[model samples]
Target: MPGKKRILVLGSGMVAPPCIEYLTRNPQNEVTVDVASAADLDTHVAAHDLVISLVPYTHHVAVIKKPDGMRWLGLFSTEPASIKNGNIFDTLCHQLAKLLSFKPGERDLVMLQHKFIVEWRDGKKDTITSTLESLGDPEKYSAMALSVGVTCGVATQLLLDGHPALRTPGILAPYKKEICDPIREAVACEGVKLVEKVMK
Candidate 1:
């Protein structure tokens, strides 16, 4: 909410080229890209309202694990992997929790907000907003992993499908619906899922 929007961009892959270029051109937004290891993902993701992921589809569900604040996302691909299969990072967390006596339940609690401002023909203005209060179960999904990986998967898929949106070669931002719409549909077919809600 500062004068500039702070966005966390994850990964350094093919799509990172155009996407990062597009975001940096805008002076009002502060964008930082991180090739963070499993150890640092939580710190970076917590600090930004927006995150751009560019990893493989194999990593999304973990990032989406219920954290209180849900982020608006642009994803690239989806590959199915089991949540029960704990990786090295998981074991590390387990060791830390054991040493510190931190109950796993203490980790749940994510909060996210999205706001839309609308203007009418009469010049009246109103704001529409949505909030997500999430309870994270890292076992269900790794919020850190999904937060940084899902968008990359979606972006990756768009690149592969040659979604009608990438009609140009020179540096271009892929946010247009002509591009986003197809990417969403394509990701759905690939067994990827996304959910959004409006609060009362």
Candidate 2:
């Protein structure tokens, strides 16, 4: 298709399907999933317009640093190994998932909170806290999967749409309100809840 946007997605764990589904909803998007590794990283990275790194956080720095001369937007999510072999990381993840698996009709909850402190020269300090809490439908998606996957999808779409803050050259983290608000709003539209408070 003409004017299609190609997206390369790294990792294929639980969260991946939702993210991939969300992106492909747009007819112009062509998303390809890959198990990110040293051998195939460059070739895949160079081929796609954007790369979503859903691989484990420990591997992020290495993945980001590997494509030296390549330019592509990236959205990072935390998870485990990308390799398909029966390694320790893969085994541990499998055992952990089995142990934590939710029973039928049971919903999973996910909560994320961030606190920031600001102080004036006069000595007064104020604390700001932001929280996101999402509950997943037992018949549909897990809270962890929905929260991470939808947020990743939202960020990826924002980047593709050329959101001002996200278009910057190097690595981008959604720490700022400009970048985060849109994601938060989009995630909420997908049924995730968000709250913010300030305390002096």
Candidate 3:
């Protein structure tokens, strides 16, 4: 395989550890992980080829003060409110697939990825959809920020394995609450269903 790209993941707490674990698992990429403080973000942002910002959406501006060469995969789901519910289950399943690959013992989480659906109630009609792999590709040189509870490694993979066009630049996956909550809930439930139906 070609040498892995030099990647830098910036964040702390819950998301950071797993991000490090996932990215390091693949030898195709060289990952340098760090927890950035407010003061160091600017210099650190400039040093890397790709930056996966696991920071909250509210803090995106602070993290991505300027655009750089790195590819970012925001953990936010960009699906329309109308179809979010049906897709949420599938999204959890995909995420479960990734978690299973990374941490098989954590099957309980798959169930959490299921159960809940995204509810969009406007004046006219209401709709629900799933947020499993609903996340689209990260925009180029932009700060991709994900919200709390975003754990769909599948979407993360999609961002990591961005299309050929992304090669010229980098990609980012910024996850948001609307995207993460359902996946976290559904994955737990789906894991239970999968073990009973297929794995058994």
Candidate 4:
């Protein structure tokens, strides 16, 4: 997916810089990098092979669907239970509240760990069950996968490893089951897939 084809990344902000770095460094050999607001999106969609959206979750709806030829990747936090389920939403809110309530000095690695777990449980609870129940559909379930399954690290790895198409170009799920235990490892190994897709 390289060689001068138009690659427009839709954002120039803190959330987008990391993926930007990846694309700039990787060099898709004809890829062009352009940044613009969500408002100017329709103007570029038809000319591009991809649109990496780093917009806020609230703004995600504006760009979720693009022209038939273009590929869209949405980068946002995997929290707050994206599906329309009240019980799941409440659980995420409660956990997020706990993370926010931690005192300033008290916000150590452990607090981050707790935050990670809360985020995981919020997504895992749904993803695992969905997959187990045979209710997983590539098109329908991809939103959930992007929200809970993919992480920055995993996304990066998928691209660097030349396996970008393996998943739906989303973030990797946070570490669990001992394989992806360390946060650094999680980001490095799996989260890169999302990075490569966006930045590339």
Candidate 5:
């Protein structure tokens, strides 16, 4: 597809499909999935306009460390020997894939909540909380996979669409209202439930 935005997806785990499906829906996105290892990172990352790391979070830093020019979105985690050696990384990838496989009739759950305390100058304070609970259907995506995948997908779409906060060069997190509001709305549109409340 000429003029399409190329998106490189680094893993083929359960989460990859939802994210890939979401990106491809735009017609302007051309997404490629690779069960990529360290040796393949440079070539694959350099070839795409955006990269989503659905691989084990440990490898995210290595992807980010790749030469500039590509944007990325996904969960991130710690360093490991796999970060340096392609062969070790390949072995670990196989092991991780085995662990992530779901059996028939199996289901998963994900719950995320945050509480914030706000203080006023007059010494009054309020408590605010936001909560999200998602349960996976055995016949479909797991809660972990769907939530992570859809969130990554939404952020990727926003970047491709030239979202102001996302277009800046550097690592970005959804800690700010500007970044979180759009994502929250889009994720809700996908049927994920989010609830917010205030207590004084």
Candidate 6:
């Protein structure tokens, strides 16, 4: 496990070949891909340390909640879901559809939230929350599609490089500077401007 990396890619689709190609080029990495359905999720996902879902966005959250053996997942979903929902795909679909249906010239958002609580030596307590929002190009990159795609690619690189900062993973919010800043820069280079704001 120290020298080699295992990556599992779900759903063989138009996006699968390129990601598979990129990972396999590294001799230390082994990539396995499958057309997995919801019924077969836990079994298909249990083997790999790093998982990437190229399936429809609907299946992304389902891949994340399994507390079975795994280190991380690169989920393509644009919305968040609660573990209690049981049917993650259905809940996520309803959220995704609303975002997609926004009219041109209406701002679409990519929001990230980080919640922190601290207890001081004096027994004082503090709760802090930081929120980041990246607004999309209303006319061109409608629904922030360009931003999301580029951010997903950046996340893959972060996982491949073994970035240790996001070691504790469930859903990766990319709210911190390490993840968001690079992604922000990368998307900017593509000429799809992402206007970002932060609040605490």
On TM-score, the candidate that comes out on top is 5
Rank by lDDT, descending? 5, 2, 6, 1, 3, 4
Q: How would you encode candidate 3's per-residue C-alpha lDDT over 1-200 as one tens digit per residue?
A: 23565667665534455445555666676776677566988887777666776652223222333344111222243643333337754444344333333242221122123333334466443333332322212331111112222343334433457633223333333365544444445444422122111111
The Cα error of candidate 1 at residue 58, in Å, is: 19
Per-prediction TM-score to the true structure, in the order listed: 0.37, 0.67, 0.36, 0.35, 0.70, 0.42
- Per-residue lDDT of 136-191 in model 4, one digit per residue for the tens? 23333223233333343235434444552444445555344332433334543423
Deviation in Å, model 1, residue 35 alpha carbon:
12
lDDT, each prediction: 0.53, 0.76, 0.42, 0.39, 0.78, 0.59
Best by lDDT: 5
Arrange candidates by TM-score, descending: 5, 2, 6, 1, 3, 4
Which is superior by lDDT, 1 or 2? Answer: 2
Q: Candidate 4 overall Cα lDDT vs. reference? A: 0.39
Q: By TM-score, how accurate is candidate 4?
A: 0.35
lDDT measured at residue 168 in model 4 versus the true structure, 0 to 100: 44
Q: Single out the weakest 10-residue window by summed lDDT for candidate 5.
A: 68-77
Candidate 5 deviant stretches above 4 angstroms: 36-38, 56-101, 117-127, 198-200
Q: After superposition, how far is residue 75 of candidate 4 from its true place, in Å?
A: 30
> Which residue segments of model 6 deviate by more than 4 Å?
36-40, 57-150, 184-200
Q: How close is candidate 5 to the true structure, as a TM-score?
A: 0.70
Model 2, range 67-182, lDDT digits (tens) per residue?
A: 43222211232544344365755554544454446788998778889998988899989899989888878787778777789889988888888888787888887789998888
